[model samples]
Target: MPIISVTVGVALLLVLMMVFKLNAFVSLLIVGLFVGVLEGMSPLEAMESVEKGLGGTLGHLTIIIIFGAILGKLMTDSGGAQRIATTLIHSFGEKRVQSAAVITAAIVGIALFFETGVVVLIPLVFTIATAARVPVLYIGMPVIAALITMHGFVPPHPGPTAVASVFGANIGLTMILGIIIAIPAFILGGPVYTKFFKKESLEIEIPKGLFNPKEFKEEELPKFGISLFTALLPVILIALQTIVQIVAPESPIAPVTNFIGDANVALLISVLVAIFTFGLNLGKKMPEIMQSLSEAVSGIALILLIIAAGGAFKQVLIDSHIDKYISDIMAGSTLSPLILTWLIAAILRIAVGSATVAGMTAAGIAAPLVAATGASPELMVLAAGAGSVTFSHVNDAGFWIYKEYFNLTIGQTIKTWSVMVTIISIVGLAGVLILDMFI
Candidate 1:
């Protein structure tokens, strides 16, 4: 009965968002209350479930998202992103501009959120497309593929990091494994997928105001190395902690490593460094830099709420004993926990169209399997994350973002963007299974 209620609840969510065009945050909260009632909770009890879910999820995510946002905003505002793109493009040259764009995308994707990455980089992508005398999709596809893969699989990108928290996966280990898995997936989704598309399909007129051909003067941009460092600092710090804990668990320096290497602390330090490297040192005023931080925080208000709502929705399932219903079925099945988690997330992604919501809800249902089956939580995070990007269609904002920006038809978006995401999803699961054999 609980499972049946949850199934109807998901269907209702799709109707609220798709048919009635409700906001995702509001829809999720409504669905949370609906599911709770269906599972036999009192109104007060259901409201409490939603509150605990919202508070628990936001408590972990807010600081990390804030610092990450500031770091990314600074990188974009001070020309650090430009510096990396231009230098990489030049290094690889016009002949390999696609390679350069995708590389820049992968690196920048590590810092910026998916939507932010798209808006910030699309102009640069168009500029690169023009200078290189190529179709926008030639470079755009690979760039988008890289960014999407990172957003789906990598930490500090909200989707992956949020899911990682739900699964209690180590952020550091998740990032390491995420990057390892994301590379080949991106290659397939990016470079390989581009080759398979028809030339006519890839061609597009630049959207009027999205193209900015004026380059930032070389003197205006930050140095490539510093730009790279500031963007990657959080990763470096967290990863070093993970490594040190493993290699030298008893090392006196482990204490120091743990302190500085925490995901929050690391990002905080990176933000401070970026304020200097990407802000004041670039000749921008302190107030201007602070203003950028304010803007960064403001931009993510809706996204943060959506994630919090997802958390609430997940909490409702757990409180209602519905997670046990699903977990019981999963435990008795012949399926691997990893694959099953992916499948649940993939289905939710298709129905709901938000990776964070899909991954969070899937984790809630599958997390017990991690302990029951002894599968690695890190791999489950990756599996759920990978599945979260399974199919991007009309429901997915990313699909429309791709379709409109590159002027592709709905059919073309399916042939390209949707198919490419599926490719990434499969490759990601394969990579996770392979890693499981070793780790």
Candidate 2:
């Protein structure tokens, strides 16, 4: 029942997950039970703890994740994603493809979940890279970096969303801080990194039956302006809600702010706008649009499950008292809570292979410290988020996705995407720490 033994047990459990290729939910559940038993709970109590942890955590955020997935699917399948990418490319010009790729990924990532954003853009990336005579990694790295940044730091995208929920931080403040850190992370980790790591030009082929680059006949494609608006509507709505809550908390609009600025409502508005701009106005039948939405949702089922399992795993960590133990240890140390959050998240991210899990676990463990120190909860959230996304390796799905999509060998993925994620984590942590000084 020693803390050292408990720490070693948790570490070994994560190793087992990698070695046995165990499902993260099951692995964490087993680990939780073991930790609980070691901490002096009966076996029955340990089992019950798992159930309580999963149920407690999932109750609040599951619906938000499901709705977010559905919205992403709708946007991806209706060609709204394509419209956004094509417009950005034209507006930014070939020389600025890195900037365009980063912006597109960040915007779409905010609208869609991470996996959905990558799947929707992979084909477009191939087409653009071919036309520009550049290495696909030149384009892929920037885009994937942006998606990773948004997925980790932005709201309503599972990682930060779950962190905000766990810590009881203001969702609006989290969203604002997420954006403030995201811009610099994208620039440092995206375009600048892409410039240095540009790879050899190699031809790549899109899979057959995937949407062709030319499928949208010029006449049927929505206007660039309309497509841009559709892509940005949700972000604007959510930002407005956050701004109003912060700047005009006593104003008349504050009472109904949740109704207008709720993440679900904001996304629902975007869905309606997408139906009009990309579906109805484009002459698509309602049935066809509905079909696209259904398929899009189906495509993201695996991702949703992974995220849910991550949530379940996090709940176990909390229930097992592992989080409290770590928080207590950090509280007794000289290290700042901000730095401790980042370090814990970064370590777990490397061990567990999922940024979402790392972020949630770190936040859960760090929440008590934030309370004890009376530090800004917003900064704690940002530090945890940054730490969660610090590194990528063969075990991480995002790393493999980047490797396969860009035809990079493992070494190249390490050099490019892996390094980019590390930079983002460090830069994001620095931003949070600096803000900690002021706040």
What is the alpha-carbon lDDT of model 2 when measured against the actual structure?
Answer: 0.75
- What tens digits encode model 2's per-residue C-alpha lDDT throughout 274-392? 88887889888999888877776676555455445555545555666666766677666888888988998899899988887788767755777866667788778888899988988
Candidate 1, poorest ten consecutive residues by summed lDDT:
207-216
Off by over 4 Å in 1: 212-215
On lDDT, the candidate that comes out on top is: 1
The TM-score that candidate 1 achieves is 0.96
**Tens digit of lDDT per residue, candidate 1, span 166-200?**
77899999999999999999999889989987877
TM, every model: 0.96, 0.89
User: Candidate 2 — worst ten consecutive residues by lDDT sum?
Assistant: 197-206
